[model samples]
Target chain A: MKNILFFTGRELTVEEMQEPIPDLHHFAVQPGVSDEPKCQRCGNETNFSSHPCARCGKECLYCRNCIKMGKISSCTTLYRWTGPEPDVPKAAGILHWSGTLSPGQKTASDNVLQAIQQQKEHTVWAVAGAGKTEVLFAGIATALSEGRRVCIAAPRSDVVRELAPRLQNVFPNTPPAALYGGSPDRHTYSPLVISTTHQLFRYTAAFDVMIVDEVDAFPYTFDHSLQYAVQKARKTESALIYLTATPEPSWREDIQSGKRDATLIPARYHRQPLPVPSMKWCGNWKKSIVPPAVLEWVKTKEKALLFYPHIETMEKALATLKAIDSRIESVHAADPLRKEKVAAMRRGEVPVLLTTTILERGVTFPGVDVAVVGAEDRVFTESALVQIAGRAGRSADCPTGEILFFHYGKTTAMVQSIEQINEMNKLGRQKGLLDT
Target chain B: MNRCLLCENGTEVDSWRAFFGAKAPPLCEVCTASFNRLSGPCCHVCSRSLEEDGECTDCQSWRKSIFHSNVSLFHYNEAMQDVIAQFKYRGDYVLASIFAEKIRTEAKKAACDLICPVPLAPSRLAERRFNQSEALIVCAGLTAAPLLGRHESEKQSKKSRAERMNAVQTFYPTGEATGKSVLVIDDIYTTGATMRLVADALADAGAASVKSITIARSGS
Candidate 1:
C-alpha cells in the first residue's frame, strides 16, 4: 500500500509560492498583499474574507451566479493567477517559438497551427513517442488564449489520463481539465478539454478547435461511428487536426496526392536513433519456450515489458519466467488491477511485465525495455508492432533501447514495421533532425 | 431503366416530376402514394406492410420463418437500394447517422429491451475494419451489444435458402441478454432467412422475445 501520486504539473509548490489549494468555500488563488482579495466573479474587492460575499454570497467570496446554479461545489481554482490579467500572456502576445524542431514534430505542428489559425483541416503523421503531444502545446495555448474552446481527444482512457499531466505542466497557469473514465473533473467546464474520442458524442459544434490524437488507434480508427463523432463535434468553421503515428495506406495516398495537407514528424524527441527491432525466427514459436538469446537478454536487462500475442501465452510465459525468477508478473485486458501492475513497473517494483497490446502506446517508463513474443502473430500487425517498439527509447534519461522480436516466421508485417522505422529514420536524417 | 420498379412504364403515368424523367419513369404521384403507403395492412409477425391481409402467409407457419417478428422501413426498391449500397460499398459512414434519424421516427411507437446488431464474424470484421450494421445502430442513438454467433460460417451469399435455414441454428447466443427482449438490426431483410435464424438463437438463449429492425426489405 504505497502512495500513488502522479506528476500532474511541474510540482507547483516548488515553482510558485502560495499556490492556492482547493477549499470548500473558495479556491486558493494568488491572494495579493492588499490585506484583501477580490472575487473574480462578484467584483467585490473588500470585506469578503471569512464572511458571506457582500454583493450576493451564501458562503465566503462565493458568487451569486455560482450559488444559484449550484455549481459552486466543483469549482476548484485551475491556476494560480500570478499577475494582472493583461500582464500574463494572452493568445496573440505570447512569443513566437521556433527552435530545433525534432523532424517528426516540425511540419506537423506548423501545418496544424496554420490550419487552426486559417480555419482549415490538416493531418499529421509521425511515429510514436515522436513527441506528438509536446509539439501541439504552443498551438493549443495559442487557441486557448484566443478564447477558443479547444479539445484533444485520444482513443483510449489510459492515454487520456497519461496526457493530462503533461498538458498541466506546460500550461501551469491555465490548468487543462482531463476527462476520461471515472475522472471526478470529467464534467468540469474548461475552455480546453482532453478526453477519449468516445466522449465527443456528448458534444456538437462544441469546440472551435479539435485535435484528434491517435487517429489510427482502435477502436476509433476501425469504428466509423466515433469518426463521425469527431466530425460532428466541431464548429462549422473550426479546424480539424488529425495526428497519427501510423497513417493507413489510404491516408498516405491522400497526403501524397495533395488531396489533404499533411506534415510529418519523423523523429522522436530524444533524438537518439530508434532501435531497429530484428525478427528472430524460432520455428513453432508458440510451442517453444523463450529462445536462449532472448532469455539471456531479458536476464541481463534490469527491467522490461515482455509483450505476448495473447493472454494465454502471456500467462504461460509468466509462469515459466516466475519459475526461473519469482519477480516476473503478467498483465492483460481482463486484469482488474492493470494500473497497479503498470505503476509497479514504473516504480521499479517489477522486473518484467508480460502484457498484451494494451500497453502498446501512451505509457512510458524510463530505463525500461521491451521484447515481443510471437511477433509474427496475427495481432502483431505493422501498426501494432511499431507502437510496441516505440514504447522503448522514449525517456530522455534512457534514450537508446532494444526491441527483440521472437517469431515463428518472418511475416510481411514484421518486415514492414522495421522498414517503416528505417524509412522514418531516413526522413529524419534528410531533415537534419537526427541526433549528431 | 431496371424495369422501373415504381412505375411499370411512362404510359402508366399521368404526370411526372422533372427529377423522374424518361429513363427513371416518374412514379406519377398516384402510383407513388400507392406504393409508399403502409396503411393498408401488414404481417402480424413481421410487421411488414402488406397490400392486403393483416398477416402475410409468411408468418402463418413457423416452417416458413424462424424470425419471431420482422419490421422494415420500406420495400427495397431502386432508391432505398441505392442509398444502402452507397453506405456500405462507398464508405459513407455518415449515412449511418442519417439513417438512424429516419429509423427513430419509425421506431417511436414500437419498443424493445435492447438493440443488438448482427455480429460479423472476426474474419469479415478484420477485412472490412467495421461492422456496417453496428455503425447504423450507433447512428440511431442506440447501443449495439454485438456479442453473438462466436464461430465463423460460410458467407450468407453463397448458401441457398434451405442451406441458410439449416445454418441458422448455429447463430448461437452468448446469453448476454437472457430475459430482456431484443431488437435485432440488419442492413436488409431478404427472404427473412438470417433474421429468423438470429431470432431462434436469441429465444434459445432465453431472450424474452425478439423483433427485427431493418432499413430495407427485398421485394422478391
Candidate 2:
C-alpha cells in the first residue's frame, strides 16, 4: 500500500519502480519525438535524435533535451498508477507560526488564499524580505485543511533548502517532503511538498495548489523545460500562484494593463524602505589595486559583503583583501566549502565575504553593508541588482544599511534597479505601508 | 550557437575550424580537460597504467590470452564513469558522438581488416534500446561488422571480480572471421574478462589476429 501511494501521482518507468502493482496504465516513453517531435516530460521540441533501438529493431527518435532525467526511448513504456488516488487526511492546526504579518503581507496573503479557494491563477509581486514565505502559509494551511496537496517550488536548490525548515516548523502537524536532486525524502508521501522546480519532472497532476516562488530566477526563466514541468505537475483545475520580488517586464505590463491579476507588497515587514545603492566610479578595479573607497569601508570595521562579476576576479580580489584582513574569504557555486563559509559569515566570523551572483538572492545578514564591485557586468541584471540591495536592511533591529555600487561604468540595469527601488518606496509611502 | 553536449555551455567555434567545414567539438575546453587521457608507461596488453613499460598484474595472470593487445584512450576515472553512466545506462545515444574523433584515431591506428563491436545479449539489447559498443563504432563513422553474438547472462556490473573472471564464455563468432584481422570495440575494458572471452571466440573462429579498442580502461 505504501508503494502504491508512492506511485499514485508519479509517472515512472518499470525499472524505477520497486514493487509490482496489480494493474497499471502504460504510455509510450518517447511519444512521437519524430513527426512533430516534443518531449512529454520536459516539453522539449527542438533537440531530438534517433538511434537504433533494439526493442523496436529500427531507428527510433528520442528527446536529447530531457535525457538527463532518464532516456525515454521510442520503444520504452512509462507506467502510472491509474487506480484510486491516495487518500490524504486533513490535519488539525496545520500552521503554528505565531509571528504577525505586516499590512502589505496581509493583503497579499489574503489574495493568495482567495485564489486558492477560487482555483484561479494569481501573482504575488512582493518586494524582497517582505515576508513572502509567510504570505503563503495561510493559503497552504487552507489547502491542507481541505485535504488538497500543496507544493511550493523554487528555481534554485538553495531557495528550496531555505524554505524547507520554515515550512516544516510552521506546519507542525503535517511534515513536508523536501525534494531535490539527492533528497532523502524522495519517496515520502505528504500533503505539503517543498521542492525545486526541476524535481517536478517526476510528478504528474500531483499537486492541487502549486506555488512557484522566485519565478523570475535564472534557469527557470530562460529554460522552457522547467516552465513546462511546472505546468504538468499540477492538476488540470488547480491554483497556480507566482511569487517574485521582480517580475519580468512582460508580466509587469500585463499587471498594469489589468490582464493579469496580482497583489503587490511594496514594503518590507520592518516597514522600512529598501536600501538604495549609490553609484561610485572605481577606475580599473580589475587591473589595479583594491579601490580606495572599498578600503575605506573596510576600515569602518562593520561586516560587509563585496560582490564581483566573475569567480576569477573574486579570487584575485580575495588575495589582496585577505592580505589586508586575514579573516576575509570568498565563495562561488563550485566551492566545496561554500556551506561552511556562508555559515561562518552568518555567525559573524567573516568580516567581508567576496562572492559571485550565486548569492544575489536567498541570503540575509543583519546590519551588513553591501557593495557590487562590477555592477555593470552583464550578469548583474535589474532583478539581480535589486535582490542584492535587498540583502541589506533585513532584520528589524538593523532596518537601514548602506548599499554601494562600485563600477567602472554604470549600465542600464544599474540605473533601472535604482529606479525600481525608489518606485517601490514611493508606492509603499502612498499605500501607508512605510514609515514616514 | 553551438553548445557543449556534456556541460550545455555555449562553445566557441573558431572561424578557421568552421571555415574548413569541420563538425563542432562535442565538448568545451573545460569539460575536455576533465577527462584524464591515458598516457605514460602502460600495460602493453590491457593498456592499464603501470609503473614501467610492461604487462599489468591482470595480464600477467592470463594463461592463454588470444588478443594481441587492447588500446584505451581515457582512464576510467570519476569523470569517465559519469560519462559512461549517462551515455549507456541512461540511454543518451547522442553522447556517443563525444568519442567519435578519438575512436576514429584509435581505430585507424589499430589498422585491422574488420571492426567488430562486442555484441549485447538479445534481452539486454531490448532493455537498453541500443548496444553501447555498436553505437560507439557507428558514431565514429566506422562500419560496425556484427561478427559476434552473445548469450544471456547476468550483468557484468552485478558480478564480483572472481565471478566475472570465472564466468563461462558467452560470445560466439557469427560473421566471416576466417583469415581476417579483427578489431573488437567496446565502451569499457573492466577486468578484461569480457574482452578475453570475445577474443577467444574470434580466435576459435579462425581469425588471423584479434585486437581490441576501448574508450576507457578501469584501474582493476
TM-score of chain B of each: 0.73, 0.96
For model 2 the TM-score comes to 0.91
- lDDT tens string, model 2, B1-220? 8888887787777889889887678889889999999999989998988889998888889877667899998999888999999889988888899999999998999999999988889999988888999999999999998888999998998899999889799999787778888998888888888888988888877788889999999855
Against the unseen true structure, what C-alpha lDDT does each candidate score? 0.67, 0.86
lDDT of 1 by residue, A156-250 (tens): 88788788887776666556668765677643556667888766654555677899999888888776656766776677889888889888878
Q: Candidate 2 i-RMS (Å)?
A: 1.0
Pick by DockQ: which candidate is best? 2
Candidate 2: tens digits of C-alpha lDDT, residues A1-436: 7777777677776666766554444332334243566766667888877887887878898878777767766655566666777766767326898999999999999999999999999999999889899999899999999888899999988888888888889988888889988888888888888899888987888889999999899889988899888999999999999999999999999998999999999999999998889999988887754688777776675588998989988888888888888999999999999999999999999999989988889999999889999788899989999999999999999998989998889899999999999999999999999995
Worst 10 residues of 2 chain A by lDDT: A25-34
Candidate 2 Cα outliers beyond 4 Å, as residue runs:
A25-35, A295-302, B9-20, B28-30, B33-64, B75-79, B151-176, B190-194, B217-220
> How many clashes does each candidate structure show, in the order listed?
5, 0
Model 2, position A22, has a per-residue lDDT of 47
